[model samples]
Target: MGIIDAHHHVWDLSVRDQDWITGPQLAPLRRDFPLSDLEPQARAASVDRTILVQTITVPEETPELLALAAESDLVAGVVGWIDLTASDVAEKLGRLRALPGGEWLRGIRHQVQGEPDPWWLTRPEVLRGLRTVADAELVYEVVALPHQLPAAVSAARHLPELTFVLDHLGKPPIVSGQLKPWSAAVRELASQPNTVCKLSGMVTEADWHEWTVDALRPYADTVLDAFGPQRLMFGSDWPVCTLAAGYAEVVDATGVLLAGLSPDEQAAVWTDTAERVYGADRPNQCRIRRVSPRGDASLD
Candidate 1:
């Protein structure tokens, strides 16, 4: 079976500075990370397709990603940034779909993690924007911090028609080993039938240099129990995960975390869930290729 990385990102420093990539800790990510750098790594890991997600909230970035997706075979879908509070948000969505390679625009994402107000997702304008996204037959990805999960839950409950994808398990407190509030909030969000969670970004949340699969198990297990494999998908979180682990390491760790599941259940996390959630229709001609034990590409 083919695997789909549900979340990853790329950026060109020459085009625009990733303003968020500041300080000594994030220095490694300051350089450009184009799709060229990721394709090989993804192929090496047997990842047939990926969902390119937005790193920064810029209006122009979405179109650029769509164009890239149009040109690439690996990128199956894109979750882009859009100003949820914009008065003409619905019009914006329509215009975005009308752009070149717009069919790859599977979902919308905002940096809700950076918003100061914990209740930002509940704002009237934001809710209206989310409904517009739903009306457009798109999913809404929630990139929220743990404290903001209550609002995410509220938004999911309010818009049953919209599929709210919770990124990074709402970024649980892995380093601190705390689970209470984070786990509780995640369970609550998962209770909403429309809500789904990505098993990504945990490596960066832990002690980067010393993290082990056991350290990540709790957070992974929580979401698995809450959302089930059918509602949960795997994400590399790519260049960002490099802060703590390499792409292959992240993929291997996820496999270890999912070792207890049946093959069908594991298949859901590996590929099926992402395809279903993002509506990424794989064409008959676009067969997935797997790297052989001898390091040659072979049809899956």
Candidate 2:
């Protein structure tokens, strides 16, 4: 059986600055983590296909990722960034779609958690960009901390047609082993059919030095309950997760988290949901080494 890692990042250290990794808590991730270091880990875990996500919101990074996806057979899709608040969002999105491996580009993401504005999603310009996203048939990757859950929830309700993927399960309170407000917001967010949850980035939220599957179960259980198997998909935050656990460990933790789900439910969470969300342009096949049409670059 194969797994599709729905979330991961690859960046060149020689490229533009990634200031976020310089912070004290994130010091472990200070170096460049390119695709070179990622291939072996993906192979070890049987992750035949992966979606290459952009690490920064800068305009150039999206095109760079698309270029990588163009060259790498393992990159089945890409969730690139776009400044959703820009006035010419539609034009910008159109340009991204016109780039090389543009077809590999599948979604939009913003660093909502980094924004000083707690109500960042409510910005008029941001909604304008989201409207453009729906028009372009792209998905939205929701990256937010626990405090930003309400903003994400609000965006989901306002743009019912847009496909929104909640990253890292909204970075729930796994470290403290509590699931109150996190569970509440997740349930509310999942109540909207257009929203889906990615079981990614759990390691960064847990006690990295002392994390365990038992500590992650409650959070995972809520996502499975709220989104169900049909709306859930697995993700390994990759190099970033490496700060706490290895790629195999992240994959195994997801396996442990979903042990009790039925076979069909397990299949859906592992493979089906991502196909339904980011895969309208292609067929859904589990264990595919690479998408068909078999081009080194996206011919779409």
Candidate 3:
């Protein structure tokens, strides 16, 4: 079975600044982090293919990611960003899919966590754009914070046709070690059959300097219980996760968290869920092959 990393990111600082990396706490991500820098670590962790996600809300970024996916065997798909509020969003999505590596454009995302309004996702214009996304057969990745989850739930309920992939378990408050509202909200979102979640970004959300797998277990278990293995998938969160743990640490930590599940259930987290959700099993994917260093077994 192939290991499909459902979420990760790459950026070229020299080409354009990731304005979000401003504070001293985020200084480590200041340098250029292209796919070349990530490939080695991903290979070491046995990750064969990845979904290159959007970092900024800029439209141009999507085309670049799509082009990168077309050229790189490791990047099977891209979750690009678009202006959902634009009147011509459907036309713009069509234009993006018509680009060089258009087929690799699998989904669309916005930094909903950055939005001040909790109900932003439920706006009429946004719902209209989401319909366009669904009409094009692309999923919409929900990048919201815990407080914004109710709106996410409402949006999911309103647009049941759109498959909403929840990123980072709605950015749960793990460091605080409380799970009241977050747990209830998560269950509500998961109740919608169109929703799924990625088990990623937990390390960074915890106390970056002192997070332990034990501290993250509760949140992971909550989502697993709510979404189940079939709707849950593994995501490295890559360069962002570097702020707390390296690629291998994140992978190993996920293994520890999922150790209690049966092998078939674990397989869904490691591979099957992502492939089925993102349609990565499609024939057009490049399917990069890498041999585990311990032996010559190829993950082809």
Residue pairs with colliding backbones in model 1 are none
Tens digits of lDDT, candidate 1, 1-300: 579999999999999879999899999998999999999999999998999999888899999999998899999998888998888888898788788868788889999998999999999999999988877777889988999999999998898778788999999989999998999999999887777789999999999999999999999999999988888899999999999999999999999999999998899899987777776665211222221112222222
lDDT of each: 0.87, 0.80, 0.87
Error of 3 at 98 (Å): 1.1
Question: Which is better, 2 or 3, measured by lDDT?
Answer: 3
| For model 2, the run of ten residues with the poorest summed lDDT | 288-297
lDDT (Cα, tens digit) per residue for candidate 2, span 1-300: 477889999877788778677667788787778887898889898887888887787888999998888888778888888888788888987788788988787888888888999889978888889988877778888888888888888987898777778999999989898898889988888887677889998888999989999888888888888877877889999888988999999999899888898898888778766765667235221211111111111212
TM-score, every prediction:
0.93, 0.91, 0.94
What TM-score would candidate 3 get against the native? 0.94
| Ranking of all candidate structures by their TM-score, best first | 3, 1, 2
